[model samples]
Target: MTRQQAIVADLLHACAHPAVAGAALFALSADAIERARVGAARRRQSIGAFVAHSVADFARVASERDKALLARRMRGAPAPIVAGLEAILENPPRA
Candidate 1:
């Protein structure tokens, strides 16, 4: 798999094991690091917490956008299928 795909797969695997405690190392530009530091300070949170919250927020937003896009695409589908998809979206199955 590609590097980005591999990273995403690794992250998903890590998430499946919440009991595992570990640190992730990322390479960022100096400016990016400084920006994160400033943002963390503003929120009175540590850099790690700030970054974790940022990632979680981003994932939530992206998931919403993806669901909206899928709903739009499903509009032309048969009525029953669209209804079923909507129901599933409204109440997704637990992992």
Candidate 2:
């Protein structure tokens, strides 16, 4: 696991107990997080995962509903290296 992934895993207790917590939390850019939070509040919705949600939102724009669903389900919960999540969210996503 990468540093960020390891950190998140430790926070989620995945490192201490794999069976209980198989998920790994990834780090999202501050801008993306803020944008997601603000946008959600503006739209009267909750921000799920800015980076992952951005991907899914695009999938929806492309009319890939299934992909959007899956993507939204996956936001911030899993990734090969949690740090890479910053790349995904650096551009940020709006709600």
Candidate 3:
């Protein structure tokens, strides 16, 4: 198995409940898993590709959300989560 697939599998297997495992796997695979759900293995992409695309999409969302400069200037008391999110926006995740 590829490193990406292994990591995904490990994450799935670590789930304590059967339903949670299925839910996590379904979320990770998303479209690819749906293709397989209809008995179309040939139409499904690799789990690793799905994971990469999902991560890239989420990163884009994070970048866009952080792009609003006004977010850094919110008035009144700031929520702890917002403060932490602001810190993350100021300093991006390491590649």
TM-score between model 2 and native:
0.35
lDDT of 2 by residue, 1-95 (tens): 55543543333232223222113222544664565567557766545433335444432343344334334434565553343333333433233
**For candidate 1, lDDT tens digit of each residue in 1-95?**
74433443343344223122113313333554565577669989765565455444433454645445434544445542223223332333333
Model 3, 1-95: lDDT tens digits are 74433433333233323344234444332443453243223436443343333333324444534433223322232332233223332343334
Model 3 TM-score?
0.23
C-alpha lDDT of all candidate models, in order? 0.42, 0.40, 0.35
Which one wins on lDDT? 1
In lDDT terms, how accurate is model 1? 0.42
What residue runs in model 1 are displaced by over 4 Å at the alpha carbon? 1-6, 9-26, 63-95
Error of 1 at 42 (Å): 0.7
Rank by lDDT (best first): 1, 2, 3
- Candidate number of the best TM-score: 1
- The runs of at least 3 residues in candidate 3 whose Cα sits more than 4 Å from the true structure, single-residue gaps closed, are 1-43, 63-95
Q: What is the TM-score of each candidate against the true structure?
A: 0.44, 0.35, 0.23
Clashes of each: 0, 0, 0
